[model samples]
Target: MRLVNTFAAAALATGLASAAFAQDPTKVGFIYVGPVGDFGWTYEHDQGRLAVIEEFGDAVETTFVESVPEGADAERVLRQMAQSGHDLIFTTSFGYMNQTMNVAKQFPDVKFEHATGYQRADNVSTYSARFYEGRHVIGLIAGGMTESNIVGYIGSFPIPEVIRGINSAYLAAKSVNPDVQFKVVWSNTWFDPALEADAAKTLIEQGADVLMQHTDSTAPMTIAEEEGIIAFGQASDQSSFGPNAQMTAIMDDWAPYYVSRVQAVMDGTWESTDTWGGIDSGMVAFADFSDKIPADLAEQAKAAADAIAAGELHPFTGPINKQDGSPWLAEGETADDGTLLGMNFYVEGIEGVIPN
Candidate 1:
């Protein structure tokens, strides 16, 4: 009797699996690290999610958990989505890397995508934009507009991604205005508005006339407005938050990429691969310059952006050096993807060490 019951249970499970496989719509899920209302990282990613919905309509079912914490809660949420029969899941934060991998292991049939992460599995894929390209543009503007010659940068963490942005910004700024300097402060958390605001005020106090950030909050731009200083936006357009202070914004347009990925899944062509898109690919976009910048400067910034998009320039073009005054890149040379992906050192002339 026990053997007969075991066989019946196995048959029922197989039937259920077959029924699910015959379903028409694909189920996709997203996990976010910050509130969608933040109007920054999460908001841009949410735009992509909405695009997926608009593109697929009834052919796909989508769900998202916003403000999901990075560690244990992330793992739990991902596991639940996999168990709930989600065909694909996008974990949209670097901190969710391990959690995504762990959940992917437990559900071999489900596909997982991670943003700004390096790890991958047979079932996992990673993607990120070359935001350093936009950073370079903003740095050029900052270098041209700053009266104090001191530009401020508020970083979200000490990771390679943040470090690369800082280095790119500094290099661009220095190239344009040799006297320009950078003051960097790490908030250590991605979405802490209070910390971001505080960093902005501190940098301003330290004589920074222009502000930039890798954080996912509008607080820095808001502070820049109140202080009558200039600033740039990150991840999304933030001109509404600081109309007078915001010069330009570095936008991460995930809509195209999201639509493509979902289409691939629907067409049964989806595979785990690493995708690093940039200005040329339309992943990195820049907002229009504010009126605070001179017309010539704005035009120059636009020309630089166009050159970058046209592959006429690279942000890390050498005659560059490490922070310790050692030679890094020779003239007319550019950095490779491998070194840039794992960059951990500051470029020459940038002050301070990268916190671990």
Candidate 2:
């Protein structure tokens, strides 16, 4: 009877210990579109992941799979993360939108955040930074510094995000230098070094003295440096890759957002939300201008960036027209958020079809 009582008591103690140890650390997962060492888009996002690690040392555990392709592979990766007991997962690419949505339905308990996408669900959220604001500042610098009156732009896709950057850059450049023209080449990729380098060479051959890119690799920057032309960094600082060619960079700061979202999940306050943060919110920032840029031009760019952050100026405010000369924004009328989110056509003076 004593042995039986002791066994029951031990079993009760074991149950209590099991209950105590059942609270595991919150698990977070990240899916990257490119390698973390790309030193551009994926690099910036990996920094955010590191920030999450720093913020919550023992309370949270983070895992990442880099260079995960964006179709069926992405869906498989997301499902695997969910099955592994991940409390939160971030799909950091536009192509992962539908996949993210599909996975969210299966793992309704897991929180998912998709970057640069509009889709959302009860367990899914959307987030993006206003990179176009930074593009405008660089455009001004590119216009003032170009010697051949031509600025070459490298694009990843013809999506609204990339299109918005192109248009914003062109408008800012035109405002600064009336004779400046933009030569845009779509690489149809986010991170292909050979293709981006080839595009840069093609543009340089066609008389582009300044280079800009919406792609993620540093190939364009390297080409610009080798050719003695100035260029702007895409998602992160590429000055090391192009000491003299890098005039400035549009930095994506996702650390604060990532930490906050993770904390939200921990606090039981996480809800599906769409967050589009910009310069005003510190989501989009800039690297220091290169010494190659004239001091006056650098000052103007800084002042313009300040004006943008302070709401004193709007990049899309204007009398504008579509590619076919259709009236779009009237004089002094700023673009609405909805129109900008769905932007697909080039401005009146851009001189090209959107490549449906």
Candidate 3:
């Protein structure tokens, strides 16, 4: 049910993909917050792990622990990986940030990569895709297609990443359909199917005809399919779960980065850095557009996505305002990375307070 775009495979064909095999297999470890079968965020990440194997073959031995809870459990798993001689470790969850750092301090030799976190250290790197870019495109489609103008957004958290997505998607929807309103319900957890399904039904009851989710499950998509409403897939393609409902999906192509980072460790050229790649870099790829989408609207969505890839369109361009209606960005000015990375407040027009 998951199709990694050809773009992702092409990106995975890195400089090291064809490199000569080294003597010892590089010991790479992965920590996941959800099961690989979730068919969403964790599924895509595990796919990246598989890509590392496909590209390097026996030159690298990759191991992963799935459904590992974030916090003491994550730290314990990480310490065990480090102690077991894992040269490189990827902690693939936002909640694993502090734990990754703490464990990195203990194992100075292990290279650590933390996803969707801002903090970095001498041996730790922070990397995340511009997921909001795809959100904006889907928002455009959702805006043009929704008959009720109510788009239900299931948010996993109120952090900058989630808040930024909510704003970007809303802004794009509002731009296309002025009456389009986002009804956001935070499930708070990243991969709870029951909770996600309940949130989707609640949104439908509140008059949402289109469902969008940031959580990592197909439950919402299943609900949308049964409700005969359209929705977008998260993290990976969930088209199988809702063939008619999924308009398109945003795929987080992590294979390329994983390969290159592992190659770095092998070559002893690894250095701590922060990487934020978007559509242009293939880090943010998309699934096939549904035939149900109008050709004209599909063209518009592609054009907008192309603009984002070309860096010509920033999703958060101003004349935007704070939720309080205070001016945040001047006309024609775009938001910088710092403000976007630390984004805390909701934009104007979104209702309800962000959960603490």
Candidate 4:
């Protein structure tokens, strides 16, 4: 009798599985590191999520959890989504690398996409934008406009992504003005508005006339506006936050990539791959130059943008040096994908260490 009952239970489970397969709505989920209302990195990614919903309509179902921490909570959230029958999941933060990997291992049948991570499994893929390209253009404008020759940088962490942006901005600034120096403050958190604002004020006190940031808030720009200094936006278009102070913005448009990934899943063609797109691919873009930027400088920035799009210029060209006065690249040489992938040191003109 017990064996018969066990067989009956197995049959019922199979029947439920078949019913769910028939009724499945192509579920996709996202996990965010910051509030969607931050109007920066998380906001841009959420915009992509919304685009997926609109593009797929009734054919797909989507949900997300915001303000997820990087460790155990992230693992729990991702596991819950997988157990709930989500077909695909996107973890949109650098810190989610290992958690995503672990979860992907557990749910081998489900697909996982992580941002800014190097690790990969058969079920896991990674994607990110070349944001520093946009930073180079705005750095030129900042260097041209600054009267003090000192630029303030608010950095979230010393990871390669943020470090790359800092070094790129410094290199571009020094290219236009040899006297320019960067003052950097490391907050160690991605979206702490209070810390970001404090860092901006401290840099201003240190005589920095221009501000740039790798953080995900409008607070630094707001402070710059109040103090009558100039700043650039990061991860999103933030001109509305500081019309007078914001010179230009680096905007991240993830909608196209999101739609393509979802369609691939629907077609059963999803595969693990790394995607790094810049201006030409429409993943990374620059907002219009603010009126605070001189007309000639804006023209120069636009020309650089066009050149990048046309493949006429490379940002990490040779004749570059490390902060320790060692040659990183020889003259007439450009950086290759391998070097940029593992960049961990500061370039010339940056003052601080790339914190661990």
lDDT of each: 0.89, 0.89, 0.91, 0.87
RMSD in angstroms, candidate 3?
Answer: 6.4
Cα lDDT tens digits, model 2, 1-356, are 00111332343346652354465567788899999999999999989999999999868777888898889999998897787678999999999999999999999999999999998999999999998899889999988998899999998899999999999999999998999988999999999999999999999999999999999999999999999998998899999999989999999999999999999999999999999888999999999888878899999999999999999888898798887998999999999878888999899788767787
TM per candidate:
0.93, 0.94, 0.93, 0.93
- Where does model 2 exceed 4 Å of error? 1-22
Writing each residue's lDDT as its tens digit, candidate 4 over 1-356 gives: 00111332343346764465565557788899999889899999999999999999867778788889899999998897787777999999999999999989999999999998889899999999988788888888888888999999999888888888888888888888999989889988998999899999999999999999999999999999999999988888787888888888899999999999999999999999999889999999877778767889899888988888888878888899988999999998988876787789999767777767
Question: Which prediction has more favorable lDDT, 2 or 3?
Answer: 3
Per-residue CA lDDT of model 1 for 7-48, tens digit only, reads 323433467544654655677888999988999999999899
lDDT for each residue of candidate 3 in 1-356, tens digit (9 for 90 to 100): 12122232232345343344446578788899998899999988989999999988878777788888887988888897787667899999999999999999998989999999999999999999999899999999999999999999999988999999999999999998999989999998998899999999999999999999999999999999999999999999999999999999999999999989998999999999999999999999999999999999999999999999999999999999999999999999999999989999999988888998
- Scored by lDDT, model 2 comes in at 0.89
**Candidate 2, poorest ten consecutive residues by summed lDDT:** 1-10
TM-score, cand. 4: 0.93
Which 10 consecutive positions of candidate 1 have the poorest summed lDDT? 1-10
Query: What TM-score would you give candidate 2 relative to the actual structure?
Result: 0.94
